[model samples]
Each structure stands twice: as structure tokens, then as C-alpha cells.
Target: MNQLPQEYYQRLEEIQAIDFVLVELTLYLDTHPDDYQAIQQFNQYAQYSQQLKQAFETKFGPLQQYGNSFSDAKWSWGTTPWPWQI
Candidate 1:
């Protein structure tokens, strides 16, 4: 769940793993785009990253808002207190 207080730490690990996979696949594909294995891994990483981003935004606020703010259970507008306040 994104409910963990250690969600940031989990995110850090996920980021590192995704970065490594992306870097390795990109380097491999530089001269070998036809490598189906690398292409598959790249796609997998991209999907995983997108899921993580959604979880982060759901737990925290969006990186930025549209015309209307996202409604969250814990934080909303000025009702959201600072980290210490939480």
C-alpha cells in the first residue's frame, strides 16, 4: 500500500532499480533496437514507473494541479498541514 510511512524509501529503491534497468536497456539498444529482450525490459520498466508515480501522487499531492485540486483523504487545500504538523 502507499499507506506506509516508509513509502519514500520504497520509492527510492524502485527509482534506482528502474533507472538501472532503463540505463542498461538504453545502452544495449543504442546499437541493437532489434533486441526484443531489451525492448521488452524497457517497456516493463516504463509501466512500473508509471504505477509508482500514480501511487506517489495519490499519497502526496500532484506535482501540479489542473483547474481543480485532487481530493485526498488526508490532505486538502489549506487543510493540509506541513510534515511536522502531520
Candidate 2:
């Protein structure tokens, strides 16, 4: 397989960062459910994370297995190196 570009790693990192924020917000909101600002932030991050994942999947193949992601003519999941494998 060809070497993955720098942008691939950058985008993955962005997704990871957003996911981290979402997890933290989830924990915080669990205790302080009345914090409207935290709830809003969590929703925003969740949406953004989905968008990022979609774009990444479109360019680099599925980020998940099973029916969670779509496949083209060929299954790229097993063909390409996984995110951590790179």
C-alpha cells in the first residue's frame, strides 16, 4: 500500500481531540445535568465528530466495522492499514 499522507494523520488527530472533549463533557454533564452550556457543547461536539468521521471515511475508508459504515466495490477495511496500524 502507498504511504498515507500527513493530512490523514492530522484529520485522525482532530477526530481524537473532539472525541476526548465529548467524553469529558459526557462525564461532567452526568453530574451537572442542569448546565445548559455543557449540554450544548456536548451536542455540538457530537455533531462535529460525526462530520469529521464521515469525511475521513469517504477518503480513507471505513472507521468502523459491521454495518456502521458503507463500503464501495471492494472492502477497504481489511485491505488498508487500520488507523493505529499506521
Candidate 3:
């Protein structure tokens, strides 16, 4: 597989980091459902992650085979290179 561009990797890293935070917050919330602060933090992270994902997809293509990421004129599923190929 070929290496993806630096920006792509950077965005992926950011997404991963944000996802980690979300997961951790989710676990905490599960145990302490009344923690409004944690819930707010989780929502913020979720929104940020969504924005990052949309940006990534807009530039680099869909991360998965499904979802609303395919908003382009042409079907990009088979055209764009996969993350592993990059």
C-alpha cells in the first residue's frame, strides 16, 4: 500500500484522539450518569469529531463504504484510494 499524504494522517490522528476522549467520557458517563459536565464535554467532542470527519471526507473521501459521505457528483467509492493504500 502507498502512504497517504501528511495532512490525511494528521487529520486521522486528530479524529482518533477525539474518539479516544469520547470513549473515555462515555465510560465515565455510564458510571456517573448525572455528571452534566462530562456529558457536555462528550457532546463537544462529538461535534468536533463530526466536523473533522466531514472535512476529511470532503478532501480525502469516505472513511467507510456507507453513510452520507458520498455527497459528490460521481460515485467515489471505487475511485479514491483507500486509507491502507495511502
Candidate 4:
């Protein structure tokens, strides 16, 4: 398998960062539900992460899950591409 492109790896990193923030905020918010800043940060990170996911999927393939037809019109799940340099 080939390694992922620089752009793909960079976006993945960003997605991971946002996910981390979202998880942390959710944990904190469970105890401090009244924390507006944390809530806002969570929302912001979530949206950013989704946007990145959509962009990556649009160009590459499904980031997760199956049956998505954004990249290929055929059976995308079985044909899921590997993230590596060819």
C-alpha cells in the first residue's frame, strides 16, 4: 500500500484535531452544561470537521461508513480505495 498524499494527510490531521476538541468539550460540557464557550467551541470544531470530511470524501472516497455515492457511482464500499501513493 502506498502512503497518503500530503494534502490528504494534512486534512486528516485537521479532522483529528477537531474531533479531539469536540470530544473534550463534550466531556467537559456534561459537567458544565452552562459553559457557553465550550459549547460554541464544540460546534465550531464539529462543523469544521464535517466540512473537511466532505471535502476529502468528495476528492478521495468515503472517510467512514459505506453506501455513499459521492466519489463513485457504483458499489463504493467494496471498492473502497486505499490511502497510499500509487
Query: For candidate 2, lDDT tens digit of each residue in 1-86?
Result: 78889998899999999999999999999999999999999999999999999999899888888898889788777776776688
Q: lDDT score, residue 2, model 4?
A: 49
Q: In model 3, which regions exceed 4 Å deviation?
A: 78-86
Q: Judging by lDDT against the true structure, name the best candidate.
A: 2
Which parts of model 4 are misplaced by more than 4 Å?
Answer: 66-71, 78-86
Candidate 4 local lDDT, 32-84, one digit each (tens): 99989888888888888889889877766777764433546663653444444
- Rank the candidate models, highest lDDT first: 2, 3, 4, 1
TM-score of the candidate numbered 1?
0.58
What digit string (tens of lDDT, one per residue) describes model 3 on residues 11-36? 98899899899999999999999999
Measure candidate 3: CA RMSD.
2.0
lDDT of 1 at 84: 43
User: What shift in Å separates residue 36 of candidate 1 from its native position after superposition?
Assistant: 1.1
lDDT of 1 by residue, 2-79 (tens): 243666557656766886878888888999989998798899998887676567666655433563346576656443
For model 3, the run of ten residues with the poorest summed lDDT: 77-86
Model 2 poorest 10 in a row by lDDT: 75-84
How much lDDT does each candidate structure score? 0.66, 0.90, 0.84, 0.74
lDDT score at residue 70, model 1, on the 0-100 scale? 61
